[model samples]
Target: MRLIELYKSVQGESSFTGVPCIFVRFAGCNLRCSWCDSTYTFQGGKPFTEDEVVAQIEALQPCPLIEFTGGEPMLHERELLPLMQRLLRDESRRYTLMMETSGERPLGEVPTEVHKIVDVKCPGSGSAFGSFRMSNLDALTSRDEVKFVLRDRRDYEFARDFIREHLQGKVAEGTLGGILLSPAFHQSPSPLRTADNMELDARDLVSWMLEDGLPARLSLQIHKFVWEPQKKGV
Candidate 1:
């Protein structure tokens, strides 16, 4: 597998926020989101085999939660399947395997045991609007989560309508996991303040959700607040 960096850190978003987890960030992404913070993962990274990756995770004492994140983890489905299988089969310790994937790829190859957190990119991401795989929605179970990173009010409304059209019923029925709405974080300071360059304020997002009665939880990048926002290998 082409590995970027593997380290232990508190999960920064989703329902798992604030929990200590080991992250396996793979290198390379298919989408070029303007607000992307991990651009370094798009290029060079050290390669490691499945066994080597597992060994490194095993070294993290008392760590039970594992997240397979990426430039886009679903890009390496072939390599990830066996690694996830090995982790699931291990009897010495129980591990919770979670995958963070852009909803652009087919998710059929991933095991049901692994919890998936799929990102549905908004227009503010600079990617083509409505590029997400609608089929991925059917693939989700109650254990999985859908995340939307809002860059502005438009992005928030887009996400809101998407949920109303696709996710609200399922979420209410207990078939789909909860929805997560997060404000996009700015990677660097800008001289001029603009919606495109500035980080979306979480308070504003929260107020909008409350006013609209959106059925989603507010997610913030807790790790960014704890460490330098641009730091890699967190």
Candidate 2:
């Protein structure tokens, strides 16, 4: 596998926020979102075999949660599937695998046991809108989550409409885990300049959600508050 940094940190997003988890960050990405924070992963990272990756995780004793993040982890599904299977099959380890993807890739290959967090890129991401695979919506279960990173009112509205059109009913029916709304964190080279609106604060997003009565959880990147925003390996 083309491995990036593998380390233990508190999960900063998704339903597992604030939970201690081991992160397996894979190198390389297919899209270049203007607000991407982990551009470091887009290029070089040390290589590690599947066994070596498992060994490193095993060394992080007592952590029951594991997240496979990226540079788009789904891009490595062929390599990641077996690793997840091996970890799940280990009787001594009680690891709950989580895979975070951009939602641009197909989720059909991912295992049902894994908690998949699919990010439906808002226009603020500067990635083409509607790039998400709509089929993945049917693939979701109560254990999976959908995230939308908002940059402004337009982005919020885009997410709101998407939820209303696709996810709201399923979420209400309890078939989907739930939707997440996060304010797009500004990074170096500034996506704010490119995004349609000015800078947005968490309060801005909250106000929009309140007025619209959107059915989603407001999430902040907890790790950034806990550590330096530019820090690597959380």
Candidate 3:
């Protein structure tokens, strides 16, 4: 598998936020979002075998939470699927697995045991806008989560309409795991650790959510505030 740096860090997004987790950041992406921070993962990464990757994961010790993230981990599904299975099926120590993906990929074959946190690109995502694969919505089990990175009211509206139009039934049935609306961060945020660095204020997003009574969680990329906004890894 083409691999970027694999390290232990707290999960900065999703319902499992703030939990200590190992991040497996893979290289290469098919889509480009304007607010993307991991553009460095688009290409050029060291290659490692599945066994080697597992070894690296084991080195992180008793921490059992692992997340497969990337430019797009599903793009390397040929390798990622097996890796996830290995972690879940480990006889000595089983790991709770999660994946953060751009929703542009087909998730039909992903193991249901792995929690999927999918991103639904908003209009402000530049070329990535409206790129989510509608069919992937069918694969969302109660263990999965959908996220929308908002930059403005337009983006929020898009996310709102999508949930109302297509996800209403699953949400009402409690079959969908969660819906997260995180504000976008400036691609090049200042080194300062402050809310001003954020492209959209969380307060504004919360207000909008309150006004509409949207059944979505207000997610902030907690890792950004915990470290330098542009820092790699956690």
Candidate 2 residue lDDT tens string, 26-95: 9999988777888889999888899899899989979989999999998888899999999988888878
What digit string (tens of lDDT, one per residue) describes model 3 on residues 29-129?
99999999899999899999999999998999878989999999999999999888878889788788999999999999999998999999999999999
- Candidate 2 — worst ten consecutive residues by lDDT sum? 189-198
Error of 2 at 150 (Å): 1.1
Worst 10 residues of 3 by lDDT: 163-172
Residue-pair clashes per prediction, in order, are 0, 0, 0
Best by lDDT: 3
Give lDDT for model 1.
Answer: 0.87
Q: Give the TM-score of candidate 2.
A: 0.93
> TM-score per candidate, in order?
0.94, 0.93, 0.98
Once fitted onto the true fold, the runs of candidate 1 whose alpha carbons sit more than 4 angstroms away are 190-198
Q: Which regions in candidate 3 have their CA more than 4 angstroms from the true location?
A: none
lDDT of 2: 0.86
Residue lDDT tens for model 1, 1-234: 898999998998888899999999999998898888888889888889998999999999589999999899888888999999999999787999899988899987788999899999899989645669999888899989999988899999999999999999999999887999988878684434333343787778989999989889998777766666666677
Better of 1 and 3 by TM-score: 3
Measured by C-alpha RMSD in angstroms, how accurate is candidate 2? Answer: 3.4
Candidates 2 and 3, the one with greater lDDT: 3
Rank by TM-score, descending? 3, 1, 2
- Angstrom error at residue 169, model 1: 0.8
> What TM value does model 1 have?
0.94
